[model samples]
Target: MVINENLKNEIEERERLERLYQNLVEKMPAVSYVMNLEKEFSFTFVSPQIQVLTGWDPKDWIDIEDFRLKCIHPEDVHEFVEALKRSIKNHEPFHHEYRLIHRNGDVVWVEDFASPLLNGNNMVESYQGVILDITNRKKAEAELIYNAYHDVLTGLVNRAYLVERLNQILSRRHPFSEQPLFSLLFMDLDRFKIINDSLGHRIGDQLLIEAAHRLQNNLFPTSTLARFGGDEFVILVEGEDPRRDAVQLADQILLDFQSPFLLDGKTLFTTISLGLVIDNGEYTEPDEVLRDADIAMYRAKARGRACYEVFSKPLLDQVINRHQIEALLRDALKRNEFNLYYQPIVALKDGRVVGFEALIRWITPQHGLIQPSEFISLAEETGLIHQIDRWVMHEACRQVQQWYQYGLSSFPFTVSVNLSGSLLHQGNVVQMISEILAETGISPQSLKIELTESVFLETSPSVNQQIQNIRDLGIQLQIDDFGTGYSSLSYLQRFPITAIKIDRSFISRIDAQYSGTEIVQAIITLAKELGLEIIAEGIETVSQLHWLKEAGCDYGQGYLLYRPMDAESTEKLLRNIGKGDEVM
Candidate 1:
């Protein structure tokens, strides 16, 4: 009887331990499961978490006619079953992620892992594993991928994705008539900087978002638009005839900009320039393709903004030449390879030499006597103009001081230096000029700063104040190329301008049959009325000079009077003038 009681206690203890194991399985986060592999994955045991995963009770899952069919997503069921069969047959472990349909029709993502169970003889008996809800992790992964490929500001595909897609299209194209064609439209918004600076970055950001959305709606079905950052965008298109398609698409984008962008209760008008390149399917280089489009876009900007240009070899050559010249110019500045040629300005009445305009010359070792037209604009664009302008100012002032040593320091017998718009806006520009003049010991009255009408475009307080600061230094301020741009009367009334140079265009038209005579005469009359001096530029013929003289112009400078010469020749000419000898 004692042995029988001891046996009963042992059986009770064993049952208690089994219940403890079952309790732990039911409370676990993941579903602990066991399947009878003999009956085609028939479930012999399941944790309570299975109900949380599939919305089915464990007992109900056991009675279900087809539990796999009910819980597994239909599309993934076949693959899951095949992999399960292989694992069970080979006694291998398997891991997979797939959708599970809940009783409430919600699709849940799960990480399902299963391993074949073995008996004492090392033969497969059943399968057991767990299902983890990786739905949150999957969503996080998907979102990560989306963010990686898209731009943060514009929501367009970023440059990386665009390049990837471009290379793919390039690699897949056929070699002949059966091959497809693709084009890249590289473009940027013109005058965006003006708006961005005048307003704020907030307004600029809104404008970009709106513009991107508008451009997106106008793209071809097989095209991708990408934001290349900060006013620049690129489009990739595929078609039977990509060149023609590119034109149409670019036109549509340009047309979209015609309608003003309404941003934060402000209507802003802007235009874009486009560069197009058609792929012949012979290359798969992304950089080359992008570079070609960029080159074309710049050409469009050069020809004038608000237009598009197709890629050509000449454009590429021009870009390459420009880059090489830019590098050379930087070197030229450092090597002191630049020289100044003086062009004499003469009084119209007495044929007396008044002053000389300083002209820059780049005597490049590779290319002799590089003219300003070839590299001045490039310098301005490259932010190297400020340094070049400063050097020119210093040289001109020093030359005038040297002229003083020769007793040539009078009112109009000074040196005139051209000022770039960028230089004028540079910080403490007036201070810099004052320091240069103080250092060179050139009389402020003997140095005149010549500016174009672009200086008068904005009467902003800063611009006006800067102009006033320079004027306060007792240096002469004159407007250069007056008639070619906005000849605003406000310029005389607003700034400290003392003279106006009639543009070479208007001076070239000065004749007995001059069509622009009224314009020039009116400008002269306006200058005289404002108590400002007038100078006529580019007087090539005797008739043009005679007309300018007869028109009561104060001064004239051109080939008719005296061509630009070297400093030594200018000194000789000045000596003759001091001797009262006729220069004309």
Candidate 2:
């Protein structure tokens, strides 16, 4: 009776232990399985969680031959099987992360951990493993990688990815030839800043997105387009004829931009300038290629918007020269290398000097007497024009004040200083001018501000307000080089413009043909109708002067009237004028 009771108690203990093991396996988060090594790794036992993990019944998992192998993702099946075989043969632990196909045909990412189960003879009997679903983690990783390489605004590949791919292509030798044939096209949207400033950043961003779409649609499948930065994009092209393909692509992109972009019910138009560089096996770094392409792009812009230019040695040299000049310009102001030259604006009736236009000249030690045409645009681009403009204004005002101190106040002459559009657009421009006038102690009427017609291209209420404020200070504003810009006639009536100086181009062509004469007559007539002062620029010949006088032009200035002179010469000229001498 004692032996029977002990035997029943042992049987109950064993049954309880078996129940606990089964409960733990079923309750675990992972899918647990035991497979037979001898039967090609077929499952001998699988926990009930197999159905929750892979949508496969535990019974089917155990009954089917090689069911797990068949369910493995085709891409990873061979490696998975080989790893399992190695682990079983070597009696080692198996650990791998791979994809698995669920019964419903969805791909599931899993991290599998298994150990080879050995019998008493030290031979592998079966394998036990657990698969933990890591699908969410894998997706998160993929999303991070994608975001790192793409631009957030345009959803195009960013600069990092482009450089990496370029490096890869450049490092590898071509299969057929020693060097790879490819091209890099750098693009910039023309006058994009005007649009951005006028319409706002939100509209600017939408335009960029639309531009990316248009560019992608026009490109070939083999091309890679990247948003290099604001209003700029770069494309990498590879094919048999990269030059021809790139040119064709550039032409197509320019043509594509001919259509207007519709953003928030507003119709907008923009053009792109392209610089193309065909690989010549000379560039070892991506930056070198990008630099060349950028240089070429600026050349296209110089030629005019909506065009493309190819990289060449001359272009590179010009870029180098420009960079050197730019470096010199930064120090030019501090070194007192800049001087003002005054050209007299004469009255058409008496040929008496009524005003003088202050023009800046850079007298560098290395390259003496640099013209404004060469460095003015560069200064504006580098944001140095603000300083240059202020210097010119103050110096011109002080010089006029000196003239008055020299007893030339009876001359009734005004000094005009040219202002860049960028300088005029500054928020504090009016305040800056106010301070300059106060500090110099020059009469406001003795100073005039000359602006190009381009300044009114995108005028706003604030700009008009600034102009009004300047005019309220008793200073006159004149449009310099008029009739050459895109300003409408309404601008004359809208802004507080005191005068219009016809562009030199029109003046130079005045004696050439009847059409030129007609254009000049029309301008003078328009000025007369509006009661605005008219000044003819670049009057070089006697006939031109005669025509201007006959046409009722109020003022004129050019080589025919007076050449630009240094301060000493100008003061002497003013002194002679004050004494009623025939200086003109």
| TM-score on alpha carbons, each prediction | 0.89, 0.94
**In model 1, what lDDT does residue 299 have?**
81
Q: In candidate 1, which residue pairs get closer than 3 Å at backbone N, Cα or C atoms, i.e. clash?
A: none
Indicate the residue-level lDDT of 90 in model 1. 82
lDDT of each: 0.85, 0.89
Over the stretch 1-584, how does candidate 2's per-residue lDDT look in tens digits? 99999999999999999999889998999988888877676788888887988898888777888888888899999899788778877888999999988899999999999888789999888878898999999999999999999999999999999999989878884545744478999999988988898789999999999999999998887899999899999999987777778989998999999889999999998989999999987777899999999999999988867999999999998878889999999999899999999999999998889989999999999998888989998898899999999999999999989988889756689999988788756889999999999999999999999998878766666777888998999999999989877758988998899999998898887773334687888899999999999999999988888888988999999998899999999999887887788445
TM-score of 1: 0.89
- TM-score, candidate number 2: 0.94
Please give, for residues 292-367, the per-residue lDDT of candidate 1 as tens digits.
9999998888776889999888888988899989999998988999988899899999788879999999998887
Best by TM-score: 2
